[model samples]
Target chain A: MGFWKTWFSTPESVSATKSAAFEEHTASTGDPSANSDRIVFSTERDIDLYELEELCDAVGWSRRPLRKVKKAIEHSFLVASMWQVRGNQRRLIGFARATSDHAFNATIWDVVVHPDFQGKGLGKALMKYVLKKLRSEEISNVTLFADPHVVDFYRTMGFMSDPEGIKGMFWYPH
Target chain B: MGFWKTWFSTPESVSATKSAAFEEHTASTGDPSANSDRIVFSTERDIDLYELEELCDAVGWSRRPLRKVKKAIEHSFLVASMWQVRGNQRRLIGFARATSDHAFNATIWDVVVHPDFQGKGLGKALMKYVLKKLRSEEISNVTLFADPHVVDFYRTMGFMSDPEGIKGMFWYPH
Candidate 1:
């Protein structure tokens, strides 16, 4: 079987989870349709997705299956999501994730800003959301990485060079 | 189609492997015979097997035969293997893994201590090996999940409480 057909042809999707999470993050200063150089913040509760490949292709997000997408959603829930919007349109502009036990710890992952909207301070805005939740929840420390040049951005957010931090690696199946 | 047959019976078993590797480490100062306290740390390069299922069941590590292991191994440059030993002799005590980029970033995985040696700090000793190597190489960061009560152990090792740091979810295909 072909790669696409073999991996993504299944009709069974993790759709319609129907969570009441909207009650948690009801604060947003901007609107999805508001026209400006501004962005909107919202916490979607239930996301029904079927064609991850098609959706990711359309929006230029990485095309992965249910597993990766679910990880993205779960990570976003632990932190909060900030959308870079022009007017009513929204895209996954900048994001930071958290791994939390809700009592005394949380870790951050995949903090990214869309290349099209990088210098506009969207990253700062997204970090703002992550930091607010982490600090208020008594999650004293938040950690992450930077691509050498962007190290300054994290430093501005109160993260310093953790010369002794842990390590991350990737392996290919070839 | 039987489980064992499908598992252990491989036609190319004899000559397929490129080579076998056995590196050395200072076994934990704790009781070496305590089966549950022992953990094994190996790299993909160290593993000589091709079939993923065999690696999965090698030492009873809970993992799926996904591209993740392949990626980790590739990133690790074949320095990885599954550990399985009985006692005292410490014949590869248990199974540990890496998430490597083949060149730099790689996070170790599983790190199963044999059933009989649960709380003897063997697992921690194995992690010490991975951390030391990554740190010496000045790696990006390492990530993994410890069993809740063990979070403090990881924290002491400088892993931020970002369980959400590298969150993942799955829905297996039928």
Candidate 2:
């Protein structure tokens, strides 16, 4: 069992996954009582940085520069943005960013919906879109650090408090 | 003020970073008696899948396909693999993976050193390399889920126990 022997072999490139099962759940957007056909969701397509900054600011997140936010969106493995398009204009209503290896693990970050759109179910739809995207890739084991108030919201999406023995730790560089 | 007006501006790419300060800490390798110049630490060149699998197996992590491991190595925002090379042969002994937005936050995963290399201070050297890399990128906030026993190891590097009111949570899809 010489482990060193395999070190010199040529490495393979990562493969691309199929488009997620977005079509089946397109109707899951919007209130069932309202017209389901009205809302549109896009993933990593035609995103606007100013709207993203607004989405963060509207939720009281720190104001990061536009470039940082764009890099965050571009580097994420899955990004969900729910929009309300009228004529030629699009409004970013809900957004989330996730990073993963496209294999074993993923962690979701910055899940937020514009305050005005909170009760309209856009947040739930955006999360489901994220899950659908990960499921399409067969990547499970997702984690996220959440504020206490949103624990219930995340719980509804199948996230749970970490088990008894596990603890999350942080370090902030000076 | 119209918030959406900044949407059309072109954002700058995240900037490049200087090399992490790797001092004459080379003697931290195997034994002080052996010359320290033989070990080379690489951010992303010459990773061996078999040795990575062996490292994971030695520590009881779940077995993953070779390609998945290679992809994980390739996609990380920063990766450090400490290797010992003599002539044309190299052995990977320590490894760490971290993902970040290159701005605000980074979480480290799979910080492992070969069992044979455990007590030789390789882990500390590897973690310091990780911190140095993150510092250069200006990603100030970092987190990692650590085993209770290793909490002290991380604290030495400036990771405090997460403060009160913050809890890490997880979701595993069936």
Candidate 3:
């Protein structure tokens, strides 16, 4: 199918080169932490779901079934996470994923940072990484569902609620 | 990867059975129309991008690049469309797609109906078809981005805007 041609022709090599460049940039412009406590970010989809669920739990979010979580990750267009690496004991600290049309629009979902990792700029770093990656893939128009309390946090990162007055709506089976 | 096991193990057979049943149901309880003008809905992914683009244009939506549109369709979890059949001629009248986590959450996108087909309950039927398909897969939460004018329309079908005070946010590159 021509669709497969378009899908396979996505600029993966360009994204890989950009990701390497961003890693270098991130390393040079480091966040404050000791060498042993460095935070590393990755776009790898093979994440440890148990660690992700624990991170969610640490942030007071409800538990998602690991089976469903794995399904979500499998179907996602992009999954990014941040980890605190302390002498090979890596801990999932921040997590986010986006489902996209892989073209005109994408919506960010399940963004959470462990409570202990909050206020250390990890959330901002994680979001920046996610947005930059989307940009690398040439996807425009990123959207997200946010809790009311954290609206300002996203605002600082250039996110606006309901741009052009396009409202978000939901349906739940009764 | 265990992830592939989960992805491959999705209940395709169950969904297929439900889709066949739904097709039977629709054929029996369809909207008022002569047999010649019957509207049929399908979950098939191999839609003609040009026809879809024409339908979007007929609804006054800005033209999306067909290449990106194809990429979007390839990545979408589900793509559903409604068509008006007249003997040998099938005209695309309505379209919608969703990107899902395949378990917990799904966001409906690019919902549109040709202007000629509006006000005859085709939009409602199209949405019902999409929601039924999602429910068959056991997706719990469904969300969509709506223009302010259509908010009431979705509300009439059990969609609430920002339920429980959750907000929607967007980010665009400067």
Two-chain DockQ for each candidate model: 0.06, 0.41, 0.64
List TM-score per model, in order: 0.40, 0.77, 0.82
In model 2, what lDDT does residue B75 have?
73
| Predicted model with the maximum DockQ | 3
Q: Per-residue lDDT for A1-174 in model 3, tens only?
A: 322233235567435534553464356546555544656667778787887887888878888779989998988888987766567476778899998878877889999888876776668878988998899889888989888888899999999888888888989988
lDDT of 1 at A34: 36
Predicted candidate 1 versus true structure: per-residue lDDT over B48-157, tens digit per residue:
33444453466565654454444434433123232443343324344565433322234455555554444545555556555655655444445554455556666665
By DockQ, rank the candidates, best first.
3, 2, 1
Candidate 3 or 1, higher DockQ: 3
Residue pairs clashing in model 2 are none
lDDT of 3 by residue, B1-174 (tens): 322233235566435534543464356556454534556666667787888988888878898788999998888888887777677677788899998878788899999988877776768878888898898889999999899989999999899999887888889876
Which residue pairs clash in candidate 3? none
Please identify model 1 stretches exceeding 4 Å from their true place: A1-37, A45-62, A75-79, A84-88, A163-174, B1-121, B124-174
Residues B16-103 of candidate 2 have per-residue lDDT tens digits of 1111212323444434555523544556534667878888898888888887777777777887777654555667778898877666
lDDT of 2 by residue, A1-174 (tens): 111122122222101111222232343443454433334555643466787888889999988777777777777887777766445455777788888766667878889888977765667777877786777777767778777788788889887765565667788888
Residues A1-174 of candidate 1 have per-residue lDDT tens digits of: 221232234323101111111111222323343335345443342233343233345546564456545644543425344444345454545455554434333456556566655565556766766666567565543544445666677767666553334333222221
The all-Cα superposition gives candidate 3 an RMSD in Å to the true structure of 7.8
Interface RMSD list for the candidates: 14.1, 1.8, 1.0
Best-to-worst order by TM-score is 3, 2, 1
